[model samples]
Target: ADLPTALRLRRGAQALGGMLGPGLCGVVLAGAGLRAAMVMSLFLFGLATLAAWRVGSAQRPAETTARRGWFDEMADGLRAKWRVRLDRWWTLVGALMMMCLLPATGLLLPLRIQGLGLSAAWFGACSAAMSLGLLAGVAGLAPALIERVGRVRALAVAVQACAVAIAGIGLVRWAPGLVALFAVIGLALAVTQLVGQTHRMLAMPDDYRSRMSSAHLAIAHLAAALAPALGGALLGVATVPTGYLLLGAGFAASGLLLMAVPGLALFLRQDHEGARGWYDRHYPQAFTRS
Candidate 1:
């Protein structure tokens, strides 16, 4: 319950930043020039860094009797994550999800807009629509919707929603249609992300949380890194619409695969105590002996 709220607040802040950062840069560019805008961005980055440093300095470091090399620690994290069946399945599904979708927003969208003979301003409008949808999802819609549906079910629904939106994007050439599809994509992405985070918080033990998160991030980044090349290769051979259709099909397949994960739906549907009991019974090794 509280976890969802916390995630909402955190993601909401990020969504707002995504929406406002470009607008601020545009304002600076209009008022002064490109160089001024660049300088302003650097200044804002420095301020963010300083704030992060201050926050970190205020926290006490954890004390450990035994220290290990970074490589050894990373290996331990990977081992821990792989040992748990649920974690392993979730990580793979998350990676596939990222690979199937990241390229649509990062590379293909711009190309599709350009192919449609739309202006840069139209692209900006689509981007804003996405941000607004993201904000709406994180702030309110996701939590309420996820409460009504189990986390795993919500994730499945969100992924399918994203697939529909992506497929719609391929089929529609109108500017308004594109913008609406982008917004739906954004909302679905937010729900998927929120569910992923909430699952981690609920399922991972305290000792493994940070390590497992790092491992997940590494795998997700690797998948994301490969996504652009995959998108580019598709676009090189097929048209943009074809690329979108193929990606949407792949995404839909991933969602179907998620439904087949053993015991995941039951686990996610349980209360906190029930979930912990289920985890302990099914995956005893996931918990540290101490």
Candidate 2:
């Protein structure tokens, strides 16, 4: 479906940026001074601002039309039908996915690489491999995976895979093996996150979608913001392997909780039904196998 393609494109762009931004920053840091690096960041931010200005607000969402103030509308979204349906099962799963992996990739893995006495270049390459895997999954794997297993089941599998990969990251001493494991972890995260986002979008009604989407993004990004700090603290207290193992345990627990969600069968049926409908509309011949 077009939905899968759009999600892939969006995620691919993100992964590309994640892959490149760090290496670029490191170059600026090494070649020039910290002030030059700051200037580079400022230049990028200015370009982003220019792009946003060019985009304009011609297609603004109508969430502001609510009779109550911003806070009340935010409250409504917090209690929106889609949000209520998601419940804590999804919340924990999302939090664990973001909390465990972002930190592992962004902070722990690099430190681990450097701790092994590898060059900073190896650190950059290893970090980039995960994002590369994410891009690859978004382009080739996520769509088929979601359709084959249904979103919820796909999500469960992804989380469980991530848990193993995260732990494996701690055990590997070789750079190539570590890159492979990191790539697999990125693939799992991409599949889960892309599918998870699509599920949320499909579930939310048009009228309340914007507010609810903001709430969803807030949770995802907030965990990312916090995870680095938490992981850094954990690494301070224990070895990188132990920290990763502990984080993997959290992911495992979240996966198990998702499997135990109430009305999970109904949830899968609904998502699959929608997927089928999409296929029938977009690829009528797909129903031949229906």
Candidate 3:
């Protein structure tokens, strides 16, 4: 729990940054030319790089007696993930969730804006709405909901709600309605991200956290790249409403899929406190002060 608190805090910072960065960037871009904007961006990127390097350098390397081949080490990471039942399930679930959101927001909504013949400012407004929703999820909604319900139920509900929200985006023709839809999608993403991430860290042993996280991120990025293509294909084949409805159905199915996860089954049966109590019984010594 404590180790994952660092992750939770990171998530909160990310949400805040997402909410702030775009508007700030737009202001800079408007006031200065592209050249000045690029220079500012470069400076910020360099600062972020230095911060990341410093954090990485602070962590002491773990001591290991046995040497393993590169393939074996990689395979070991996969096997370790499989051994952690919840992590294993989430590895699949989280990927699908990641895949769905990006395409829906990136391609689908912008497409909607274009179809409506709206200005670039409308797209920007929709994007910012989603970012604000994400901020709420990480800073407000996710914590409150997760604390009241367990992560499992919260995620399942969020997944389905996200699906509905995505579908809503396509159904609406108005800019204001589209912005609201995008906001809901963003909120759902935040809920899934924070709750799912805590589960990710909790499910895997500390030794395997880095490796598992690396694998998950690689897969998510690949899925992200593929998702827009898939969205484009859907748009080509069907009208936006049908495409979005089908996409929403797919996302809804992922929530149903969660019911099959054994660890989540336990969570569904308990409130947050009961869930923690159950964890204490299973891992008394491993329990953090939470």
Candidate 4:
């Protein structure tokens, strides 16, 4: 189930890394001189566009024997499984967890350069360098970590790392430390994103993969949309660092949420037969009610 989707997810991770490299370099060069930045940004933007197109084109999934018309196929897939105690409830719980974390990450974006008192050019350089770190984390670190630790453990660790980095963002009392901290924050953000998405993909059922991805994306964007405005509002009531601290706290709490939620192994699709037999013997009436 969702073998195609797994391939697409891997490709998407690569494409995102490709865009981040040049796009950020251009942003930095622009700060050096407007004309230079503009030329570089344009060139990088063109490269990114091509990379995105390639990723999109590669997503045409090959049909398989189990494939059927989309809607009917999804319905049948859903019916074939024993509904776990938590499967239907997962959407809401997962979305709320992402909402807490994504906004906290987004809140760092605007404040990153300004808080450091660095030239926009330096910030751009960090962006480009950070992309390289992101690529390393995505392509080199992710597979080994996920395989060794399992999806839930990997994701929780990523979130905890992000929370620590977010708190580090508040330590930018000096310019030099701030620049270094921003790079670390960017690194943590990339790793967290990769691990989180992989966990989500592996946790969901095959037929609901796309819908699950959509739900994850929608909540993430909603968090991004609100973070800056909400962070700004908090700033009005407190210091800028205080606002960042609050956002960091939110992300740390999210690590707790992910840890608190039952592990994915408990809901493994392979366990459905055992679950069905248990339901038949112990909770037949409730099974029918569902």
Candidate 5:
């Protein structure tokens, strides 16, 4: 779609221009260990910061159409959204799943670094590798797997694979091996996110897409917000190893339990007969097909 193309172009330009240039300069400076280089780097960053602030101030609109604050706009949007009224059950389930699994990501890498005694740089590289693995899976591998196995089975396989990675993180003691394990985890996480989102989108009516997407992002953020707090609490009582193992086990069990729910099949089943029967009895369509 045009959306993807535009996004890719924008990202490519930004990455090539800003990120890559700064990154190269930082690496060159760090390698030199020269005081002047460090000072120059800091000066350049300060200049960049000032420029950004000036640019931001320049871009502010001259006038406002509505006097409403952001929170007011959000409240109005929620009230108007179709997904708030429709697909309530599915949205709740999706939110809960996101709450549990998404937070596990932040905990995983820090624990890998601290508990496993790997360098912080290794964590960054592992994160990138995981993202690449996910990118490869999404480009074509996931859909093909779903086609061969069907959605439900594919979901189960992805979760189970994720559990394997989580368990691997817990059970493996060696530091070097974690790089490979994290890559697997990343692959599983990527596929799981893509497939799960696709299923949710397909389950709802077209009118609900915007609200559901909003709900999805909100839930993900909520999960992220809770991660550090929960991780800190766990870290207080147990060693980092124990904390990671418990997190890993919890992730596996939650996925397994969700997959086993009785009504989940009905929610995911690719048929309208159930909806049709329910609609005919309780809330009939406004008009019939000619």
Candidate 6:
């Protein structure tokens, strides 16, 4: 119940930042110059740093009697995640989704726009559209949609939507069509993210949550790092549309594979009490520190 609200607030802030940051940077660049725009960015970064420092100072640090080494902690986190069937499945799903989709938005989209002979302003508009879509999805649309369709079904539908949008981005020549596709991609991405994050928050024990999050981030980052090079290689061998089609197919396949996994629906549908029961039944040592 609370998870949805928390995720909405968090993702909303991120979406707003995404929407505003580029537009502000563009305005600064156009009015002042590249260097001035960069300086403004640095100033904003400093403000963010100060805000973080203030927040950190206000919070009391956790009391720990014994601290493990960083590597040991990370290894333990990975081991715990792998030991749980649900965690393992979702982690892999998240990583693969990142690999397939990141390149489409981050690398290929701009190139596709360029191929259409569109200006940078068009790309900016598409970006803002994506951000607005994400904001709309997370703020109200995702929760209601998830409730109506169910978690697993909603996720499946969102993944398929992303696949279609990405493929359309490659094939669509009109600038408006590209913006619409990017908006669809953003909305779908938001749904997937909300579902994944809510599961993470509810499924893991309190002691394990941060560790599991770190482990997940590491894997996702690795997949994302490799995605750009793979995308570039694909572009080298094929046209932009062909690359998008292949990537979209991979994204769709990932959803199908996830759906095929045993126990996934049950795992995602679990509530807080149900999730706790699941952990107890499946991994009795989940809460026990080694």
Write down the TM-score of every candidate.
Answer: 0.91, 0.80, 0.84, 0.63, 0.64, 0.93
Clashing pairs in 3: none
In lDDT terms, how accurate is model 6?
0.82
Model 2 residue 69 distance off true place after TM-score fit, in angstroms:
2.8
Question: lDDT tens string, model 2, 92-183?
Answer: 56676678777777788767887777787777777788888888888878777977887777877888898998888788788788888878
Q: How would you encode candidate 6's per-residue C-alpha lDDT over 1-290 as one tens digit per residue?
A: 57656777989889999899889988998999999998999999999999888874325355561466788778878988888777788778767877888888889888888899999988888888889889989888887788898888889999999999988888888999888988898799788887767766677776676777789889988998999998999989999889999899989998888787667787778755566436546776655554
Clashes of each: 0, 0, 0, 1, 0, 0
Model 4 whole-model lDDT (C-alpha atoms): 0.53
Q: Candidate 5 at residue 126, lDDT?
A: 54
Model 3 per-residue lDDT tens digits across residues 29-56:
7899778888988999999999888874
**Candidate with the greatest lDDT versus the true structure:** 6
Candidate 5 lDDT over 231-274, as tens digits, reads 77876897766666776677677677767654555544543333
What is the model-wide C-alpha lDDT for candidate 2? Answer: 0.72
Please report the TM-score between candidate 3 and the true structure. Answer: 0.84
Locate the minimum summed-lDDT window of 10 residues in model 6: 56-65
Give the higher-lDDT candidate: 4 or 5.
Answer: 5
Per-model CA lDDT versus the true structure: 0.79, 0.72, 0.72, 0.53, 0.56, 0.82
The numbered model that scores best in TM-score is 6
Residue 53 lDDT in model 6? 80
Task: Give me candidate 2's TM-score against the actual structure.
Answer: 0.80
Give me the runs in candidate 6 sitting further than 4 Å from their true place: 1-3, 57-65, 286-290
Residue 87 of model 5, lDDT score: 38
Report the poorest 10 consecutive residues by lDDT, candidate 5: 281-290
Cα displacement (Å) at residue 263, model 6: 1.4
Residue 201 Cα positional deviation in candidate 1, in Å, after optimal superposition: 1.8
Model 2 off-target regions past 4 Å? 1-4, 26-36, 58-67, 81-83, 148-153, 225-229, 269-290
